[model samples]
Target chain A: MGVIGVVATMKVQAGKEAEFEKVFKDLQSKVKANEPGCLQYDLCKSKSNPQTFVIMEQYESQEALDAHGKSDYFKAAFPALGAVLDGAPGLEFLDRID
Target chain B: MGVIGVVATMKVQAGKEAEFEKVFKDLQSKVKANEPGCLQYDLCKSKSNPQTFVIMEQYESQEALDAHGKSDYFKAAFPALGAVLDGAPGLEFLDRID
Candidate 1:
């Protein structure tokens, strides 16, 4: 199976960018340190809109992608992230061509 | 100056996936071979919708990103790609946090 790529676009609350980023960074570090199946997980802020952010993620396979969502660190970080998010994130799942 | 990321989400016309991919691959190869400043340029197809594709790109700087847009090969591929695309692509420019 090909690698799975996930693009998550989020809009953080006006004053919560810093808090959102801190929580996201904590989650990112945990994912990187503990999840061998995850290939790439990076946070980025939109150039056109300060409130917008995107998480670019890559997993080895379907199982790996599922494992990421079910990981304790990922689940535990949700409430803090949700609190700072302006609305539901837009997610897109793709199959890496390369 | 930090790296710049570009997310280009495109929807190919039904039955034009192969043609669209071929044109995109040709462009991708040229970008990789000619542009040293481009860090990552990947093509991915949507898992949920076959017709949707996303090009994930990273550049060393804003100048590098501009160079890509102005490159001869990039400009040349537009016509073939545009013919197969369903509509204008959704483009998002980002500043890599890490």
Candidate 2:
């Protein structure tokens, strides 16, 4: 109910790295521009496994997260994410404790 | 190696969460106090699973990580972390891309 944190891992297919990042950059920019309730949404590339990417996101509330999911930008971009990813993403939902 | 980001997950042994967080708090404070190269160190608890904890840490470079691992505080606290955790922590090393 408080601020929600998300740490999700998506592994791009072997040869689709460029395309994955390109789509992600657009999603990142749109999220930043359109979602005020999205406090921070950082995109990271794994150092251990270069094909893997991690998204660290913060939302003001659960409602905000729902809103984000229902947004036009999210709808437009999510399919593109799934297309380039190797398999299902690994997601962990978190809350600030300290 | 430019800037290293780490997302580590630890699930405390049943009935030992209180102890785990206490040790973690101490470690967090010490890292902030002593590690100049650590730009950010955030502690988060799982919303989906309360016993799980996530630590998001940032270091200036690989060398800084080596220094962190070698610090007296790290040496002292890491064993405590292992003792309270249900299993070995899950660590994912990352680099900022956006």
Top-scoring candidate (TM-score): 1
lDDT of 1 by residue, A1-98 (tens): 99999999999999999999999999999999988999989899999999999998889999999999999989999998999999999999999997
True contacts kept of 2: 0.84
Q: What is the C-alpha RMSD of each candidate to the true structure, in Å?
A: 0.8, 1.7
User: RMSD in Å for candidate 1, one decimal?
Assistant: 0.8
DockQ scores of the candidates: 0.91, 0.77
The TM-scores, chain A only, for the candidates as listed are: 0.98, 0.94
lDDT tens readout by residue for model 2, A2-91: 778889889999999999999999988999998999987888898788899998887888888889889898899999989999999998
Using DockQ as the measure, the top candidate is: 1
State the C-alpha RMSD over the true interface residues for candidate 2, after superposing those residues. 1.1
List model 1 lDDT by residue over B1-98, tens digit each: 99999899999999999999999999999999999999989899998999999988899998999999999999999999999999999999999998
